[model samples]
Target: MIPVFVGMMYGATLGGNATLIGSAANIVAAGVCANEGRPVTFARFLRYGLPITLCQLAVTAAYVMVLSKFLR
Candidate 1:
């Protein structure tokens, strides 16, 4: 259950990052940023997003490992 929850969260974040306008509000926000000459690209987002996502996944794995050991 915990893994599923974590996976869902990861998936949502990934899906959001997949498109510049995935979220309703992001479409407008991205447009504004682009108009201001500061458009965000997928490469730029991935540079930071990948590490952040990996860290979150690692923490989740650690938590699951610790909990399982303690509960046993």
Candidate 2:
């Protein structure tokens, strides 16, 4: 039960990286930053975000694999 919750929570949290506008908070942040005269272009965001997000997702996947091995 706890594992299920943890997995779901982590997945949902990670989904924030699924796209530039994947989450509401990200949109709000971008809007705020833009209004502050520091606009974050989608390309700029992706340049950094894509690699980090992919790496994090990979790590999470590996973790889940190991966790499943143990949990089983």
Candidate 3:
């Protein structure tokens, strides 16, 4: 249960980074980019974000399943 909870938290954290609209820090980044006349698009974000998110989720799952014994 604890490992599952940790995995969920990590997954959520990675998801938060998936979009400029999903997190406060990224919102600021998007705003700044827009102000500079370099607005980021959803497609552009997904191109990079999707792979990163997948990798993060996979790593978190592996950790929870295989390394859970080391936790706590």
For all predictions, the C-alpha RMSD in Å is 3.6, 2.6, 1.8
**lDDT tens digits, residues 1-72, model 1?**
665565566667645644555566556776788999999775775676567666766776677667656655
What tens-digit string does per-residue lDDT give for candidate 3 at 1-72? 888888778888888887767688877887889999999887787788788888888887887887688875
Give lDDT tens digits, candidate 2, residues 1-72: 655766777777886775678788778888999999999888887787778877887788778777877876
lDDT (0-100) at residue 6 of candidate 1?
A: 58
Q: List the residue pairs that clash in candidate 2.
A: none
Q: Candidate 3, 7: how far from true, in Å?
A: 1.0
Alpha carbon deviation, residue 58, candidate 2 (Å): 1.0
lDDT for 53 in candidate 1 is 60
Reference-based lDDT, residue 67, model 2? 85
lDDT for each candidate structure: 0.65, 0.79, 0.82
Model 2 per-residue lDDT at 69: 75
Task: Tell me the TM-score of model 2.
Answer: 0.76
TM-scores for candidates 1 onward, in order? 0.54, 0.76, 0.82
lDDT score for residue 63 of model 3: 77
Which wins on TM-score, candidate 1 or candidate 3? Answer: 3
